[model samples]
Target: MAYRIAARHPGRLVTYTAETEEAALAKWEELAADGVPFEMTDADGVRVDDIDLEDRIDARGDGDA
Candidate 1:
């Protein structure tokens, strides 16, 4: 399944798509690292919870994943 990441800047919306969930999460982390606020959608284009996603990333970063 494909995953998508969308970020809204001052006046533009940027998006990125990945062929797999892993890649998508990696892309999310990349964006987060850049300090850009973004939202992620599943294959169906349904937005996931930003808080949950951030928690997961934090867990991974803490070596608890």
Candidate 2:
């Protein structure tokens, strides 16, 4: 999926997408390579769920698999 980048600065750079984690990171690196300074933010952080996070009980070794 391509992500839309909404930087703090307007008209500098915006709106991008990456198919994978590597691609997304590459996009940031690409921007950095071009000497562009910007900030990364979660534009839709509240509406998104982090699939990477596991339940605390399961991680603590007290839950059944």
Candidate 3:
């Protein structure tokens, strides 16, 4: 599966495909840490509900799988 991070305001999109969720989350965090506001979604353009960016990053570090 592919993960996507897109800017909510201007609609900039960044797509990441990784062998594992951890790797994807890592890339997401890297982009987020740059301080741009973005929303996470799946490859099909569906929003990844229930998890905020920071929380999701934390979850990955905590091994929440």
TM-score against native, each model: 0.63, 0.42, 0.43
The candidate scoring highest on lDDT is 1
User: Whole-model Cα lDDT per candidate?
Assistant: 0.73, 0.44, 0.58
The worst-scoring run of ten residues by lDDT in candidate 1 lies at 48-57
Error of 1 at 25 (Å): 1.1
Flag regions of model 1 displaced more than 4 Å.
Answer: 49-65
Task: Put down candidate 3 lDDT per residue, 3-64, tens digits, no spaces.
Answer: 66555334655545543455556755766677656666766667663354346556658575
lDDT tens string, model 2, 8-41? 3345556564444444555566766776655433
RMSD of 1: 5.2
When 1 and 3 are scored with lDDT, the better candidate is: 1
Model 1 clash pairs? none
- Rank by lDDT, descending? 1, 3, 2
Error of 3 at 4 (Å): 1.9
